[model samples]
Each structure stands twice: as structure tokens, then as C-alpha cells.
Target chain A: MDKLLVSKRMKGRLVQNAILQAIFFFATVLGLIALMLLLSHVVMQAIGWLDGDFLNNFPSRRPEEAGMKSGLIGSLWLMMIVAPVSFILGVGTAIYLEEYALKNRFTAFIQTNISNLTGVPSIVFGLLGLTIFVRELGLGRSVLAAGLTMSLLVFPVIVVAAQEAIRAVPQQLREASYAMGATKWQTICRVVLPAALPGMLTGAILALSRAVGETAPLVVLGIPTFIAYLPSGVLDTFTVMPLQIYNWTGRPQEEFQHVAAAGIVVLLGFLIMMNSVAVLIRNKFQKRF
Target chain B: MGIPTNQEQPFSVREMIVENQRRQHWPKRMEKIAPKLLFTLAALSVLVTLGILFTLLFETIEFFRRVSIVEFVTSKEWLPWNEEHGSFGVAPLVTGTLLTTGIAMLFAVPIGLASAIYLSEYASERTRRIIKPALEVLAGIPTIVYGFFALTIVTPLLQNVIPDLEIFNALSPGLVMGIMIIPMIASLSEDAMSAVPNSIREGALALGATKLEVALKVVLPAAASGVIASVILGISRAVGETMIVAVAGGSSPEFTFDVTKSIQTLTAYIVQVTTGDAGYGTTIYYSIYAVGMTLFLFTLVMNVLAQYISRRFREEY
Candidate 1:
């Protein structure tokens, strides 16, 4: 009886272990499968729309000739504006909080609020942008307005990241700099800022990548569904890649679906390239440290 | 002897003089300026939050004046473009938002929590590192891509299986949104699980518990608060998700609970009104603010709850 009981327990344990292993294996494989499905679906549908004219021409009703040139240019313009503004404001706030502020209730309150802001729905930021930037400020529905909206949407994220990067810099480094008789400003600008630059850059890259892929804020900011011309200025009305894809996908025409897939391929490709560069920079910084 | 002593104290005199001068000027200056700078920055962050609240409130109030609050809240129909017969019932949008978010949480929490358990307890260090970055990649995929995936791929697959699925239904979008948020829950829960002391695991194992038992009975219960917080945050993400719902959840504003039919979320409603030809200053245009205010308030509550739960249950060793 004792021998039978021991063997049964061992068998049950083996079965349980096997089940646990199977669950983990299944999860990992599911993740990979989702990724593969994303890539393959886009590629298979995009190939039919790939041609020379598809790269240079403006968006048209025809699938064989419609290109994302204007949408691409609009995205570039939006990034150019959003990146600098968000970076400066976000990094500045982080430096103040992490380096200068005393640990007090007020500062703690701000910190908590900032974190909450990070959790606030992206759509809320869009609504805020629509009310404040678009209507109250009279920026109108333009690239500048969209960029500003996106900047607000990502501001909290950048600040949070910047704070983390700044916090990760060892206190010993600051002490050593102070011991060298450096002024607070000098220490921050010359020693601390440089040391934290790589992390800050990575954060900025991540935030920008997020902004580039964002569709909700732009959609709420009144991004045009179709724009045949490239934005000539910051205030020029424009369409983004996601909005264009959205427009194409919603059409009943099969041809538009192909174009939408092609747009997805382009958007994903851009995201991958941006992420790769970020990874490269991060690795280089890691090696240096 | 006095002359020799005075000469030997040269270094001390120089250091004392330098320190006295620096302390007199630098410390006073830093003490005066640093607090002010810090206060100003902190104030700015507060101002941003206040600004968002005020902006949403003012516009939302203006919107309510045009459309009665009772009508906006109780009506089941949301047709802003048709001014001749406009009904601004926000219930359907609210229901749709909640249903989709519920579906997303259902998909995200279990998978994410399980993945977190596997990573923290079962996986080797090498596997942990690999999986961590892979999960981050999954998190970093743009919601827009997820939206496209839902519309083009998941929708077609569902149609094949269900045979009656609409071109735009809630299931595919909710599923995709769930997938997008899974990484968030996993990463946060993993952080919580990893923070559990190894001693706890060892104790459970010593009691003849299997690895799975050790994980489920010890680590999960210990990390429950953080896991719950992560789930709340994920739901917040799903509720705010716009593109997927806008694309895959269809454009019809309906209050039905059926996942196979077209629906519209609060965020998607905002997107719809904004994209269409709603003229500036029109009641329809102002209705976006009303919808946005709802979304903002809902998310704000979730966020506050998350912060409260995280702090209240925060464990320290």
C-alpha cells in the first residue's frame, strides 16, 4: 500500500509539471504566432500594391497608383515639431523633480499626478487638445494642431521616462562631481546631463515612436481622411499614415483594402527601423557604462 | 616655536578661508534659488493637469447647455450630425465601451498573470531576459497596427468560424486590444512577482509543494495587489483604445451587448464626430467634448483607483 501511494504521488507530480510546462510553451508560441500573423498578413496583401508609382504619387482612388507620399511628409512634419517640444519640456521637468526638488508632500503630489496622467486615456488628451489647442487657441485643423495634441498625449510618458533615467544615475556620481568643486549648474550640465543623455534619448525615441503610430489623437484632432497634397507648412491641413489606412480599410472596395495593407506594411517598417535604432543606441550606452 | 607653528598651518588656513568664502556665497545662493526652481517646475506639472480638467469641463458644460444632461445621459441614440432630429444618448457608447473593455480584461489578465508567474518562478535567467524584451516589443507595437490586424485578419477569421459575424464587430477589436495590453499586465505583474523573496518559494517547496503550487499558492497571492493594479491599468488602456474600436467595432452607435454586431465606444464616437464634416462651433462639434469629458472622467477614476490600490497595498521588506 505504501509503495502504491508513493508511485501515484510521483505520477501526479509528473503530470502537473508537464501541464505547467505546456502552458508556458503555449504562451511563448502564441506570442510568436501573433507576430508572424501580423507580418505575413501585411506582406501578402501589400505585395499587390507595391510599385514605383505607389511610392511617389499622391493618394488616388486607384490602388495601382495611390501612394503615401503626402501622408509620409505630414508625419515627418508632425515629428519635427513634436519631438523638440516634448523633449525639452519633459526633460526639464524631470531634472527639476529629480535633481532640485526636496522630497515633500507637494512634490509627491505632483509625482502621483504625473503618473496618473500617464494612465489617463490617450483619447482624453485628444479631447483636451481639441478644446484647448484646436478651438480655444484657434490653431484650426492642421499639422501644427495635431502635433501639439500628440505632444500633450506623450508628455507624461516622456516625463516619467526622464525621471527614471535621471533617478538611475548613482548618487555617488553627483557626490564626486561636487567634490571636484563644481557648481550645481555645472555639475548637472557637464556631468549628470551627459551621463543621463543616452537614457533620455532612448526615452525620447520611444515616445516619438509612440506618437508616430498614434491614430486616436490625430483622428480626434480632425486629421483629414484624404489629402492629395503634401503639407507645405506647419499649419497646412494634412493626413497621417494611420488615418489614410483607416480610410482605405473602411471602403467597401477590395482595392482599397490592398492599399490599406500596403500602408500598414510601411507603418510597421518605419516602427521597426526606429525601434532598431533605439536598441542600437541603448546597447552602445550599456557597453559604455 | 610660535613662528614654526604658524607656518605649518598654511594649508589649513587656505582651506578654511576657501570654505568660508564658498559657504558664504554658494550655499546661500543655492538655498535661495533651488527651492524656487523646483517649486516652479512642480507647479507647471500641476498646471498641466488643471488645464486639462478645466478645458474639458468648460467645453463639456457648454455642450450640456445645448443638449440637456438628462437627454445626453439617458438617451440610447447618438446621432450628432442630424441636427433636425438629434439624440445624444451616451448610454450605448458607454455600454459598448464597458463591454469591449470587459472582454479585453478577460483575455489579458489570465494570460498575462500566468506569463508573469512562469517568468518569475519557472524560467531560467537567460529565458527571462529574452522574454522580457520580447514582451516589451509586443507592448511597443502601435495600437494602429493592432487595429489593422483586427480589421483585415481577425475579422475575416471570425467570419469563417461564426458565419454571421459582421464586417465590423466588437470581438476582433476587443481581442486585439487585449493582446496589445497583455504585455503591460505581464511586465507589471512580473515586477511584483520578482519582488517576492526567494525564501517564500523555498518554504513552499520545502513543504512538498510542486512548482505550480508554489507559484499559485504563494507568489500569486503575495503579488495579488500588484496584479490587480496591472489589470486595472490594462482595462484603462482598453477603455481608451480608439483605433481598434473605430475600425473593427464598426461605426454604428448601438447599446446591444452582442459581440458580433457593430458598436461604438466613447473614444470611437469622438473619432467619428471629429473626422466627419462637423462644422466648428456646431452642437455636434461640442458633443465631442461631452463624449471626451466622459472618457476623461472614466479614465481619471481608474487611474486614481490604481494609484490608491498600489500605494495602499504596497509591501516593503
Candidate 2:
């Protein structure tokens, strides 16, 4: 009886283990298959609409005439506004928190609050933009309002990334600078900033990729769908690639699906290029030292 | 030694003048102000939270004036645009959100936890290097694309399998959302598992436990809080997700658990009301903010709980 019980226990254990292993393997395969299928599906649908004209023309009621020039330009303008605001504020916050701030309740409050803001939905940020920037500040869904919203959306992410980067900078470097009579700001500026550039850039690139893909906030901000001309300034109304794609996909027409797929390919390409750079920098330089 | 360095190096008159000038102006002025500037920047995050709170709360209060909180919270139907005597009940929207979120978590939790186990335990570093990034690409793919994928690919495929499946059902969006959040769950769970000290693994293995046993029985339990934290965060993400549900979960606001039926989430409802359909200051327009407030509170609670769990028992090795 004892022998029989022991054998049964072992068998049950073996079966359980095998089942788990199979489940895990299946899960991994599901991830791979989903990725492969998504890419191929988008590519198949996109093949027809991705062309020079698609890149050069503006949004049109006529399906074939529709293009992404204005949206692309609008995205560029948004970036122009977003890049400087986020980086300076984000990196400055990181620098202060890491180097200067005392480890106290207020600092902890800032950290916790920032982390919490990171999880707030993009739509909430949209509301903030609509209230503060569009309504209160009188920017009115222009690129400036949208860009500031995007900045706020990405700000905490950049600060967190910059903190990680700044922290990873060897302590000895800061000590050496200080030993050489450099003040706190001088030490950070001269010694830590350059060392942490690759990391900071990676964070910034990822944040930009996020900004580029965002649509809901823009939608809430009332980014007018069809613009005949490219935006010339930050105050001009604009659309983005994802927003354009969203518009296409929502239409009842069958042909617009193709355009939507093509836009996805462009957005995916943009993301892949940027992510590859981030991965390369991480793998290449981060390990060298 | 430092005092003698200038005389030993025979410091130039121009350098001496420049050094004195720099010492007098740059440090004393900028040094005093730099910290404050950075502090203000850091404090801007606090302001952002305040802004979000004020905006959500202020509008929510406005919404409540027209529609009482009791009516909004306890009513059975949500018909903000019902033309006459529209009910502003949140039950349907909340149910829809929960159903979608539930379905998503049902799919995501297992796959994500399994993948986390595989990556942290089974896969070698070389295999991990190739697979982890591939998985993360799923996370980086915009939700709009995922929404399209669900609308175009998943819903059609489901329709084929289940002929009664609605053109835009909760099932497809839920599944797509599952795939979307797999990276988040896996990465966080993997981090948690990896944090389990190797000594614990050695001890378990030395006791004649199988690798799977070590993972399932020992490491998993050891990392339970962290995994739970990640799952809560994932739940928060699933609940707050907008586009996938909006585009593929259909526009119906039904309070049903049936995944095959069409439904509208809180976010989808917001999108519907806000996309130029409702006029400013109208009840329908204010309804979105009211719903958004509910969502904000739900996610806020989940996020705080997750944060607490992750931080509460952060294991020290």
C-alpha cells in the first residue's frame, strides 16, 4: 500500500509538471504567432496604399487621393514643441531628485505622484489639455496645446528614465569631479550628463515613439481630421499618423481599410527604427563600460 | 598643495582674472538658483496630479448637479442620449468595462504568467535575448493598431468559428487586449521571479525538487505578491484601455456577461459622447466626465493597491 501511494504521488507530480511546461510553451508560441500574424496581416492589407503619393498628398474625401503629408508635418511640428519642453523639465526634475533633493516626505511625494501620473490614462491627460491649455489658456486644440499635453503625458516617463540613467552613472565620476572642486551643478553638467546621454536619448526616443502613436488625446483635443495644408507653426491645428489611421479604420467604406493598414506600416516602421536604436545603444555602449 | 599649484604652474594673468571673475559670479548666483529651479520642475509633477484631480472632480461635480450621484451610480441603464428623460445609469458601462476587463485578465493572466515563468526559468539567455524583445514589440504596438487588428482580423475570425458572434463583440477586443498586455505582465512577473534569490532555488533543487516544482511551488509562492502586484497593474491597464474596446467591442451599452454580445466600455462611451456628437455643457457631454471620474477612481484604487503590494513586501536578498 505504501509503495502504491508513493508511485501515485510521483505520477501526479510528473503529470502536473508536464502540464505546466506545456502551458508555458503554448503561451510563448501564442505570443510569437500573434506577432507574426499581426505584422503579415497589416503588410498584406497595406501593400496597395503605401506609395509616394500617399506620403505627399493631404486628407481627401476621394479614397485614392487621400494622403498623409499634412499629418506627417503636423506630427513634426508637435515634436518640435514636445521635445524641448519635456527634456528640459524631465531631466531637470531627475537631476534635482537624484542629486540635490533630501530624502524626505516631499521628495517621496514627488516620486509617488509622478509614478501615479504615469498610470493615468491618456484620455485624462486629454481632459487636462482641454481644460488648462485649450479652454483656460486659450490655445484651442492647436499644436501647442496638443504638444503640451503630450509633454505632460511623457514627462514622468522621461524623468524616471533620466533618473535611472543618472543613477547608473558611476559614483566615482561624481566624486572625482567634486574632489576637483566642481560644484554640484558643475559636476552634474560636466561629468554625469555626457555619460548618461545614451540612456537619456533612449528614454526620449521611446517617449517620442509613444507620442507619435498616441491618438485618443488628440481626438479629445479636437484635432480636426482633414487639413488641406501642412501646419506652419505650433499654433496651427494638426493631425498625426495614428489619428489619420484611426479615421480611416472607422469609415464604413471597404477601401479605407487599405489606407489604414498602410498607415500602420508607416507608424510601425517609425517605431521599429527608433526602438532598434534604443536597443542598439543599450546593448552596445551600456555594456562597454 | 592646491594653494601652491598656481605658483608652481605659473598661472597666467588672464587665467587668474577669469578664475576670480568665475568664482565671484557664476557659482554664487547660479548655484543658489539651480536647485530651486530643478525643485520647481520636480514639483510640477505634483501640479499635474492636482490639475488632473481638479479637472476630473470639477466636471464630475458639474455632471452631478444635473444627474445625482445616486442616480448615476445606481441606475440600471445608461442612455445619456435617450432624447427624452435619458437615464444616466453607470451600471451598464461599469458591467461592460468589467466584462471586457475580466475576459482580458482571464486570457492575459495565464499566458503572461506562463511566459514569465518560461523566460525567467526555462529559456536560456540567448533565447531570452531574441524572444523578450519580440514580445515587447507587442506592447509598443499602438492600441489603435490593436483596435484595427481586432476589428479587421480577430472579430472576423471569431465570426467564422462562432456564427452567432456579433461583428464587434467583447470577446475579440478582450483577446486582443490580452495579447497587448502580455508584455507588461510577463516583464513584471519575470522581474519579480528573477528577484527571488538564487540561494532559494539552490535550496529547492538540492532537496530533489524538479525544475518545474522549484518554479511552481517555491519561486512562484515566494514571488506571489509581486505577481499579484503586476496583475493588478495589468488589470488597471485593461480597465482603462480605450481604443480596442471602442473600435471592436461595438457601441452597445449592455449589462451582460456574455462575451459574444456587443458592449460599450466606459472609455468607448466617452469617445462616443465626445466625438462632436454632444454639445458643450450638455448632460451627454458631462456624462463622459462623470464616467471618466468613475474610471479614474477605479484605476486609482487599483494602482494604489498594486503600488502598495509591490512596495510592501519587496523582498530583500
- Model number with the top lDDT: 2
Residues B1-317, candidate 2: write the lDDT tens digits.
Answer: 26645444537888777777865696768889999999999998899999989898999999999888999878888877778878988999988999889989998999999999999988889989888878877788899999999999999998889999998789999999999988899999999999999999999989868779999899998898899999999999999899899889988898788999999999888777667657778888777788888888888999999999988887767
Tens digit of lDDT per residue, candidate 1, span B1-317?
14435553546778868856865796658756765765675577787788889888887899888899999988888876675898999998998898889888888888888788888888899988888888888888777778888988889998999998998888889888888888899889999889989998899899878888888888888887788888888888898888889888988888799999998899888888877787878888788888888888888888788777877897755
Which candidate has the top score in DockQ?
A: 2
- Once fitted onto the true fold, the runs of candidate 1 whose alpha carbons sit more than 4 angstroms away are A1-3, A287-289, B1-42, B81-85
What docking grade applies to model 2? medium
Q: Deviation in angstroms for B32 in model 1?
A: 7.4
Please give, for residues A1-289, the per-residue lDDT of candidate 1 as tens digits.
5999988997899699779877965675466578787879789988968666676779988777789988877888989988997887788788889888788898788888888778778877777777778778989888888988888778777888888788788888899999998778768878888888878888888999899988888777777878898878888889888788888888888888888888888887888888888888888884243
Docking class of 1: medium
Angstrom error at residue B79, model 2: 1.1
TM-score per model (chain B): 0.88, 0.93
Checking candidate 1 for backbone clashes, the offending pairs are: B75-B89
